[model samples]
Target: MQNFFPAQYSTLSAAALKDYLIKVYQLDPSTTCRLLIRNVSDTYILENQTQKYIFKIYRDAHRKCDEIEAELELLNILKAEGNSVSYPITDVAGKQIQQFNAIEGIRNGVLFSFAEGKVILDLDSAHLTQLGRDIAKLHQTTSSLKLNNPRPVFSFETTLFEPLKDLKPHFSEMIEEYEYLSNIADKVVKKFEEFDTSKFNYGYCHYDFFPKNFHFDEAGKITFFDFDFAGQGYLINDLMSFLNHYFFHQLNNLISREQAEKDFNTFINAYQQVRPLTDDELKAIPYLGITFHIFFLKFFYDNYDDWSNAFLTPRYTKHRVTLIKKWEEMYCNF
Candidate 1:
């Protein structure tokens, strides 16, 4: 007998997953399972004649067991509060997480109720308003509670400082870009010191609220998914991420800056109708936006081995830094 060779990452077979799920979750035997996406994690779509489901297998490097449990707990809470989120589904054993030992190591998977809609990129006024209200309603639950399982926390330390330190090795070749990030991060910290953060609303933010993470049915109902980046931070972090959609839209000339502002205002107004935001919190969004960019830059660097090596080249790194500079010029006062 020969020994099996070790692997860093392995793709699980869809046919095998279909069989396992059918047996464990009591899914229809006729259901088909196909890989939907293979990124930081692997997403599979399983469906039969009557129902559809999403099974996500998380990379241990990206998300560990505790973090996955926390995410499931958050989704469970959101679903119970009547939020339109794709939530975890339990198997016949009443377990939401399924364990598998693959060639690499142990991988955790979860079956989620399929969100019934498609993504709407060019959102109209009605879509914007509904999205705002739904997000506010979701925040109502996320802001109030704490999870027993641990998840990442977004803060000056985690998002700004730690990322900068961890990314130094990756940025060794691009000293100017690294300096720009460090200087801007310092400015962001100084700017935050100026604000009376005691009034800032704190909670678990969706952290990645771009239009692509959500879907809208023909009836215009919005369902948000992909909580992979959800964490404790300023609740306004969610709002800032939504604003990023408009920022990119204006940059790419998809929408005029005037209209982007008007559209964002519509979303803000609807959000305020449901939940009140302080003036200081609104003022801090752009600065928080800086941290968002730097955090993700480090993320790309850290996950380059598992993700794309060619995607995070010196040119890409410089481009990201340039975008951060442009963001500062457009929005920041300091």
Candidate 2:
């Protein structure tokens, strides 16, 4: 079977990918080992006598802005601050980011030195602790690098309720599929609103900090990748989102709430070693967890049809409902 990116980004032709590689790095196209499609991006690998490089072709440039620039800038900032990260490869123009026009639309692209090691989800305490320390270092240093992009336009309240309000005419249909997610989302939003966002510090964060976006070397060191969704946000927001993805959703093992809480504290403690958190930030953690849960719930609900369009699986709908119920049970007890 032939493998290619979805129709939306099929503009990346094989010949074009080959040409881009040869022109950029002077590598022989015959040495092209493989090309793979990742969600909205296409990646190609080329091998010469002694070196290899990964070229990433980005789709949807119209909406992407100069995100590669932001990512490279962020990486440089983190590296200067002593955080390990993948470095972006420069183009013939001596720039990290390059713009190209394809038949489908304008496509922006960049290359990167391949990040090392494997992404381990079921990591041990030592690795998790290292992840925490590394992330803390990143957050601490990135606070000063003024970035060029804005936060993504959507969030828990705006992405969920705003759409529900507009879709009121089809309340029955929406409710049928989501099963009271809107009402639960409202409660989640209310709980978050009651808390002070000011208490939680905001800065550039790897919004999608899943294990897949991380690397664990043999020495137990961690390096992060995919700053596609990176931007300014509450610090704990990304931390909890990482927890939800690794400990909660992805593993689905018998992770006791107590154990999960311990892991969260470990990461937070390591982060605080370099930069301390305020009383308000501590208070905001629990509510922010609930808010992020509802945020993804609405995300799943809106894209209910054609599950492949999303990074989540079809079971994500059920997982979201369960998370909401868990939050409700915990909230009432509190």
Candidate 3:
């Protein structure tokens, strides 16, 4: 047999995955599997007559085995606590993660119970309130426990300073934009110093709470998924991410500033009904929001080659910086 050429990234065949999953998971022979997304990780949808599941294959560069274990551990805890989260499924051999030897190297894959329902972009008052309560309940668990394996930590060093350093080269042509990010990062750090962060609720945050990561069932129950960015951080990071939903809505003219504030406050009030948040913590959200944008900007730059080659251009970088400026202007006082 001819030696296979070395590869950086390889797309696993859906047919091969379907057959393997059927045997490992002991699924019905008639079960079908199809690729759902091919981003930083590849997502496959597997379905039989009565059941459906999401099988995700992780890229070694994006998520190491230990990090993947941590994510699965987090999900298992969430599921056990009765939180509505899509969780990993164990195979007949009691293995939650399957090892695949692809052209590049050994890749890890997991089967997740499919989150039932659809994304509701135009969330109503009840939807927002339920979402808030459920998220706070989830925090009740995530905030209290520690996982055996390690995941990312969203600190000023990781989210702000390190990203700035890593992104310096990408912004070589956009020195002004780079300076803006650096200055704002400094401001954010100083702003945090003004607050009594001792009272901030510390825990693992979803980090990407945009509506798309969650689904609303026919009865309005919400199930959150996509824990790829879940990490150790202030619990408020989840609230900040959900707030970004309204930020973009107002930015796109889908909703007025007045309505956006009203809607987000609905969520905040509901969250507080479940778990209390200090005024200082609420005040610090905008600054943390600044870090959120900068962190993702660096993510795009770093993963561009593997994730979004077409989307990460100089123009996109400048546009992202412009959006960050707008976010600061809209929310931050300093």
Candidate 4:
């Protein structure tokens, strides 16, 4: 891994930044700027002079600059169709991604048109239903574009299993739980693979559609950001990520089986109303949803070694156990 550039401090001086803006984006020097949140790769959010352009600086150069550029291009395509996506701003010559030299290493950056809405986590049933509709619209829009980007798969294999492979020895203490989830992940892949996924006509999708990455305005309209994980996949896989978070993870209590079924069906039905699901997709839902729950539970649980700095609570762990048992009883006929 390359050394991380310090994102906490702005490497560009105020004067230097102003000059760069003029060269890259043709902006004024007296722009007011404020810091937003920092991401894993140390991307910094710098509001340009007009308050319209938000620059995303990738502190790490080797981590697929081309992929990020492609993601921005996809967003631009979706936004042009009036799909409510965050669009990237271009250089002075109107290029989306700008390659620059930095001390930590060679890195890339891109500017985006600031999205207007706020990140909404707390929502009522109506709002949840709206989210379903918006996501369906997003998937539909991407499908129409037919843009293909061959990125890494975001299933249990890539996101969870691969990252945790080295930590398997550390998982010996929790061998029972680890092995159980490992087997479950394998079963899910096998079951889903049993059918021809291509038969369902895989399309481009925002693979990670969690609430934090979404925005909703005062008028009940929703928009999305963070297309970093956007790629080709079965549409239901995206649905599973959203439903798993809502039904199992987000709620405060052990979600009652009845409520779980209700919430799941509500979301699925609302989505299908806008963009219908195929028969194979409907059959795969129960397993895929449960698999998502288990995958994230173990994924979070396996990160306990870093728990010292982590704010993860005991309640979170208990909820995973609860979810696992409930999924087993509901799906496996326990």
Candidate 5:
């Protein structure tokens, strides 16, 4: 493997950021920026008088400018269609995204209108239904939107098939389990190779629609933010990612999976009411959802040698394979 730039996602210091915000964004000199979270990217909350905004400094060398701009374009399209998204705002020079020299290194920066309302961590049926409807609306809105530069596309091969191969050399204690995952990934590829995925079902989608990425208001409106993972891919991919992660949370007792089947139906039916998912896409959901487990398995194994302590034991890895097969069967029959 070749060497590449590692993430330099240190927090933004208030002193170093004042000049840029004042000169470019025309904010008051007394504006205060608070570091919200330094994970993956440095995110800050900027407040001056009654105005509130989000300032994000992208991790150096992690994402390209054009790709970030494409995501920004997606926000504009959704907002123009009255979809209630927190869109990106431009500075005085009409620049939607800016790159500046930071104390760590050169990094990309963009400002956004703060998505209002408090985040609801524990979701009920009503919230889930509205969430489903909201995502379907986004899929419908950006179906035909064009972008000069787009992010990478994902597939069984990209998400699962190739990652296993690349991580083969990294396996230490779980080499056998890694081999089993490789075979499972291969079977997934061969089984689903016959379908045509490009039949108007592919478009730009929020690749990460996990629970915490959206917020709800008292008036029962849903506003989704965080388009860092937005890209062109199968529309169903978004739905599957949501469902798979929801199930993962359930598996760990983070939430109630007792209503898993019923809730799953509600979300899918709500989505279909807005934008009908074809029979083929419906059949493919289980297979597509398996991609997440495969991707994360490789991620946990490669990045952290502590996967054994954190996740299933080697014996349970095979157990997980069995559990996944049974779950897929139930999902396909659902």
Candidate 6:
């Protein structure tokens, strides 16, 4: 028998939460607080008499002071450049980063200006093109600004090495599949080591650049949030992350592969307008696509419990393998 323990989350009373907000952050006492989502972090909707704000409480030990500050610094840069983003709000004390002991043992809290607009369901050519342009602008700006606080590097170790370490044990019974994946992961790591990434532009990037992470109003304006996965890494990783998600949806039959291909072309073409990808960066995309596959494999391990009923089973292994094979066939050859 194995011992399985569910994670326990600390809670705060409504009164206590309101008091903390008013006293610590100096918000209006009459403000109404409501829970939003409690997945990676505990997010809340903070509504005052006139305005709204996003209250994010980092999970215990999930992030440190420097990492949060790094994100805020990047946001400040984006805001200063007249880029539309969910800028972090300064408290009454003029401090944006606030950490204090709360329902969670020790949580880091940040307040962000509420972003207006809604998720785009219908992706028109113009919408997709504008998105690509905005992404290019983001990359161009961040490429020049230097961050004093270190953002975690999204490299082979975090995405592949650590993930394979945790996963090999879970699926050890399937010797052939496990070993095959192990070899593929090893090759990806070797590629990372051999490639001179300096040839391609690299900078602070949102590793989770997907549609759900931002908002698009009618005028094609974008207000992005959720810097939880933001880190210093190759810019291509961001593009591939979006592509991987779209490709996964395509595989699931939610969208046609042709549509996915069109989106990819549209995004890349628009991106080229502001900051073009070099021939070297384009060549590196396939290898990075393999890295994307490795990232996807690790997601199944982390979220298996959440999707076990729907897909994470023996089918999960086959699904991962199929994705790897599919990427290899589609990209590696090109």
TM-score of 2: 0.79
- How many clashes in each candidate? 0, 0, 0, 0, 0, 0
Model 2 Cα lDDT, one tens digit per residue, 229-282: 676667666676676654464246656666766776777787787778886677
lDDT (0 to 1) per candidate = 0.93, 0.65, 0.94, 0.63, 0.74, 0.76
Model 3: lowest-lDDT 10 consecutive positions: 303-312
Q: Which candidate has the top score in lDDT? A: 3
Write down the TM-score for model 6: 0.85
RMSD of 1: 1.0
Error of 5 at 187 (Å): 2.1
Expressed as tens digits, the lDDT of each residue in 246-265 for candidate 1 is 88988898999889989999
**TM-score of decoy 4:** 0.75
Whole-model alpha-carbon lDDT for candidate 6: 0.76
**Which residue segments of model 3 deviate by more than 4 Å?**
none
**Candidate order by lDDT, highest to lowest?**
3, 1, 6, 5, 2, 4
Q: List model 3 lDDT by residue over 116-168, tens digit each.
A: 99998888899999999999999999999999999999999999999999999
Residue pairs in candidate 1 whose N, alpha carbon or C atoms collide under 3 angstroms: none
Tens digits of per-residue lDDT for model 6, 153-231: 8788877777778877767677777777778777766665656767878888888877888898777788888887788
* Model 1: lowest-lDDT 10 consecutive positions: 302-311
Query: Which parts of model 5 are misplaced by more than 4 Å?
Result: 1-10, 194-200, 254-258, 296-334
Ranking by TM-score: 3, 1, 6, 5, 2, 4
Backbone clashes in candidate 3 total 0
Residues 160-200, candidate 5: write the lDDT tens digits: 86777776665557677677677667766776765565553
Q: Enumerate residue pairs that collide in model 3.
A: none
